[model samples]
Each structure stands twice: as C-alpha cells, then as structure tokens.
Target: MKAETVRTTLTIPRELLEATDKAVLEGKAKSRNDFVVQALRRELAAQKREEIDAALAEMASDPDYQAEVLKLEVEFATAQWEALQLGETPK
Candidate 1:
C-alpha cells in the first residue's frame, strides 16, 4: 500500500542540508527526504517516551505507592541481613 505524503517546504540551515545530501550519497539514506522523515520519526518517538516516563514518575511519587515501596525496601534489607547472619549468600 502506498502511504499518502504531502509536499511541504522547510527552511533549514544550508550546512544541515549539505550533510543530509552527503548521507544520501554515502548510502546512509535512500534520499534526503527519507533522511528527514526518519529523523522526524525518531524525534517523535523520543518525545513519546519522555511523556510516558513523566507519567510514570508522577505515579511513583503518589503517597500510597511511596509507602508501599518503602515497606518493600525494608523487607528486602531485613531478608538480606538475616541471610548474612545465617552465613548464606542471598543471590
């Protein structure tokens, strides 16, 4: 299936355009358009990941979640200390 694409004009720095063309000639990209599209896709994906990470950080900072995490940490430390006292390595 062919994806519909729109023609657009963007004013980019001359050096950047030159680099893009170089990439195409070096076979790093099929063409300048492909290089730009791939760059945009990567940037968009990175933005999405940042959004998800922010949401997760907010959720983790919730009072209830923080309390549970603290409880688990204490339990883990106690278990590790007990294992050491018993001369057993806690793997």
Candidate 2:
C-alpha cells in the first residue's frame, strides 16, 4: 500500500491545547497528532461497539427474536456443510 500525506487544520480551546502540550512535555504523549488520533479512534470504536452490543442484548432478551436468530444461524451452517459435501458453493 502507498502512503499519502495530507494536511488539515484544527481549532481547539487554548486551555485544551495547553493541556495537550503539557501532557507531551510530561511524557504522556509522544506527539500531539498521535495523541489526538489515538484518542479519537478509541472513542469512535467504543461508541460503535457499545451500539452493537446494546442491539445484541436487546435481541437476546426477546425470546422470539433469539429463537429466530438461532434458527437462521443453524440453517446457514447446515447449508454450508451440505454445500461442502457436494463440492458446491453455498449462497
């Protein structure tokens, strides 16, 4: 893969910027860009995982929904097994 470099601008409160600078000076962060990028990525990943887990919990809590999902999964696995036995592709 090729690497591309792009430049962007950010506007943050003075205090926040100062805090970030202080963190870097104190060895908390290697670089301001690295710190901000990592923090943003972690926050976004957590939000997405939380949403998925909540939805899964809701589905599992409903007996009917859980049954339907289990049925579908079983059907899917059975179809895949049959396809493999027959040397055919499973949809």
Candidate 3:
C-alpha cells in the first residue's frame, strides 16, 4: 500500500492518555497512535451507518417518499449483487 506521513496534535484528557498508553503496553495496539486511529475509524463508520439508517427510516415514514426510496434501494441492491458476481467489493 502507498502511504504518506503527516504531523498533527491532539488535546486529550490526562486519564484517557494514560489509559491508552496502558493499553499499548498490554499489546492491545502497536502504539498509542494505532489505538486512537482504530478507535476513530470504528466510531466514524458506526456514525455513518446510523445516519444512513435514520434517513431511511424517516423516508419510510412518508408513503410517497417510501416508495421512491424502496425503488432506489432495489436498484442499489441489484448493482451490489452484480458487483459481487464480478468479484468486486460493494460498499
């Protein structure tokens, strides 16, 4: 994989930082940076999923919007299935 490096700073609670360091020493992560990155990624993915589901639910509550969204969902599903058959990952 191609990679690039960047420098950034974060302000975190002292307790949180100490806990993260402990986790690193316990072998939960290669370093404090790795732990924070993995945690942020997981949190972001969960938040996005929650937002999508909330939007779908709101749309479903409206009869007309529900129909349109259902149609789009079907189309998306079909495309995902086709991509899977072609050995591509669908996101």
TM-score of each: 0.69, 0.62, 0.68
Compare the candidates by TM-score and give the number of the best one.
Answer: 1
Q: Mind giving the per-residue lDDT tens digits that candidate 2 earns over 1-91? A: 8658477889999998899989889998899986787788899999999999999899879999989988999879988888788886454
Residues 6-45 of candidate 3: C-alpha lDDT, one tens digit per residue: 7799999999999999999999999999999889999999
Candidate 1: where is the Cα deviation over 4 Å? Answer: 64-91
Q: CA lDDT of each candidate?
A: 0.94, 0.87, 0.91
RMSD of 3: 8.4
Model 3 reaches what TM-score against the true structure?
Answer: 0.68
Model 2 misplacement above 4 A: 1-5, 69-91
Best by lDDT: 1
Clashing pairs in 2: none
Q: After superposition, how far is residue 59 of candidate 1 from its true place, in Å?
A: 0.8
Q: After superposition, which runs of candidate 3 have C-alpha atoms over 4 Å from their true positions?
A: 67-91
> Global lDDT for candidate 3?
0.91
Ranking by lDDT: 1, 3, 2
lDDT of candidate 1 vs native? 0.94
Candidate rank order under TM-score: 1, 3, 2
Comparing 2 with 3 on lDDT, the higher-scoring candidate is: 3
